[model samples]
Target: MTALAPSPTLSETTRTTPGAGWLLRLHRPALYLWIGAVAVLAVVLLWLGGPLTDSAATAWREYDKSCDTGGSCRYDQDSIVRYKDVYAYTTAALTALPFVVAAWAGAALFGRELEHGTAQLAWTQNLSPTRWLTTKLIVPAVLVTAGTGLLVALHRVMWTAGDGRIDTADAWYANLTLHANGPTTVAFALTGLAGGALAGVLLRRTLPALTLALACVAALRFLADQLMPHLWPAVTQVTSLADGYRGSGLNVDSGLVTATGAHIADPGCGSTIVAGCKTVYADLDATGFYTTYHPESHYWPLQLTTTALVLAVAAALAVTAFVLLKRSTAAPARVRTEAAA
Candidate 1:
């Protein structure tokens, strides 16, 4: 009759009331892992960057030419484009990590309780399913978003030095930006939340919920990157006919060197500036070679816009939540072993 444990409100089937401690206990490991990884990445990147190093002169010397006759002043076919180092590499990496992290968080938050049948007991504690869901959503979302912001800051610091020397569209650069609607990180968050909620309603199990979230992320990225472009009309490339033209034979601005690459063909290739070419091109009557180079305006908009559109697909998946949860009940199918433990 020892007060009967205050009339024991919580059923044995319900999960522990899960105070703030519960969140820390459950999530700290993951938080530490990511933080550690980011730290290592930051250190490595900083060392490689050589904070005091100066490469502006070298970069300019390596590239910078003008047009006339043949066109295409700069020749850079081998090195990794600098803009790529800034935009494409960092964006791709930053955008991808969030997907997995978001999915993991979603699967953990929504799927766990439902799968455990603890939802019923937890709900009875003056809390609706929505309240419980809200707590779950807010905590993890903040953590992930904070982490994403930090990573973005880190990227900005690490790559700020390489502003020129490479167009942001060549093999490495892509002027992707987040200001566009439903950019990659935003899409990852939306999908993660929606995935968790949807998985909770549909699978009613933790493991399955996590699996579904990961699978959806992967499948969607693949579809967006590979197939989606073909679904609509292609964005025709805009070439720079102006950048062409190495100049006429008499112009002497061809920058062609005689002793350099002159064998079968006219090796009359000098530095991009006029002084470098001299009599080489004049003597050889050097034939100009030009290739199509897409215009700068076309670089940032098309791919960035397309990427945003593709990421917005999560919106469709998000809508499924209301339908699935509404049709399903929180009550257990039978019994959950985790509840007793």
Candidate 2:
């Protein structure tokens, strides 16, 4: 007679399995939401790169030929207006994605499990707390990185296509435009994942963890914006009054340079005669002007440097989360050992 095969035990199955099937199942809703968002954003970006760009170019040509010439122009004002609004919103959506990641990670991925004893239950069922947290961090980190990276690429493509054509397009250094259109977006997404996981692990309460994680992500973004200009050294050039201040990229500062090499504010006297400001202009010695700016070449360097800094912060947060998990999981064993002793 053939013996009946024994069923696999829960611990045996868990140990043998390589993926977070249960966790994925638990947050299936979030996954679907992310997919939906990416789809919508992708469609919008393609629109921006194609039809909207052409419409915007046409409107810009019309405006330049007539309105800019101090005459009336029959431009398709609605199309241009729509293009600008949509582009602004698209960039805003990409910029705001990190906060969404933080919220989901804190409330759904970590905090919910900790709050309801789910994570502890998993630990009892042959999964270690470290593995549980690692899975949480790794899975979301990968997803966030992939999603944001794709969006960044799309944003770059759209921006390149619209450059010099769309009159309302933002300068490359505009805070939202810069962050949304480069690798910094991916960096911010990863930072959000790490920060949210840490916050959730520390708070272990869904609502508060969610709120704090979003706040933390916002703070990180703000800090990044504050430090971005300093990431790369700026270039300063003095130009004659005839040339005017026409430097591009990230304009740091522009001021009048006196003949004595001292910097002074522009006297607002550009080819226009101002009687009251004669003495001021003479003392200003505005033979020429200086523009302090990060030229176009500095764009990639600034983006990469900021990305590295943000990644370092993410690494630190990940390490802290691991440490917190270890301490939280080990406390009970330590207490029992002391009681036994």
Candidate 3:
């Protein structure tokens, strides 16, 4: 009887499989760093929502009361300034997170492995290239989504806490505040991960992949900003030229309405109350100012639409990465088959 080869043991099989456990081991430092960063930011957001917001609100109330009685301002100016400073810092940090994620995903997560032949070595084991790439994308995507989602939730809480209380608080539609305070940030971070993975698979070099990934993410962000305003129907409020532009929230367009009922660009002039603005309006035959904008009621609609668009792009990028990986690995397998034949 021919001697039968022994089947692989459970431990051997587990070691060869490129699962989350091994991926975690390979990237333990990055994992720890991610957890630490998320923890620190979470703490800051909580403090901003609780203590800082309370102090700032109290100061504002005191200032308002003093102003009503025409007394000397006795509010805590230091508290207000500190609140603004912390808010600015936190907003900046949240805005920068996606780019940081892209850089790390490109350079360390995928690029370095491909550049150093580590990915190929794994392929020689029981792990297929597809499985390897899938594992890489899925695990990191989950961690990134969870961390970013938590940060976004905390940021919203912080922003909402100060609403109508702090006089100088950022508007809900402020560019950075809008993105940071919604699901859009989470979607953007996921897109960055997918874009970085695609860059790595295409370039197969660390620095170049990192640069390309950053560029891709930046472009996506720019496009998302431009696209956000038009995602929902904006309400138009037309007022007499003397009233000037009058709508609040996310402004889509503000222009002059002609006597013929046509919208024309504003000549950078104020209301008719201004000396030259009246003459400019008369020359243009402008009758009123038309302002088109999304009110606060549309905030959720805009956020959800933008997030869906970004998530779609991310899915496409991930699929393209997988396809590229398959084609790349297939060529070598084909070559080996030819050699054996």
Q: Which residue pairs in model 2 clash with each other?
A: none
Off by over 4 Å in 1: 1-26, 34-96, 156-160, 163-183, 226-311, 330-341
Deviating ranges (above 4 Å) for candidate 3:
1-17
lDDT of 3 by residue, 1-341 (tens): 66544444424544665698778777777898999999999999999999999999999999999977899968999899999999999999999899989999899999988998888878877788999899899999999999999999999999999999999999999999999999999998998899899999999999999998899789999999999999999999999987788989999998999999999998888898888888898899999999999999999999999999999999999999999999998999999899999
lDDT of 2 by residue, 52-95 (tens): 98998998899999987888777999889888899999999999
How large an RMSD does model 2 have? 5.8
**Cα RMSD to native, each candidate?**
13.3, 5.8, 6.4
Candidate closest to the true structure, highest lDDT: 3
Query: What ordering of candidates by lDDT runs from best to worst?
Result: 3, 2, 1
The candidate that wins on TM-score is 3
TM-score of each: 0.53, 0.88, 0.94
Report the lDDT tens digits of candidate 1 across residue range 56-120. Answer: 32434445543333546554433434433544544565666656664665566667767777666
Q: Candidate 3, TM-score vs. the true structure?
A: 0.94
Q: Cα lDDT for residue 72, model 2?
A: 74
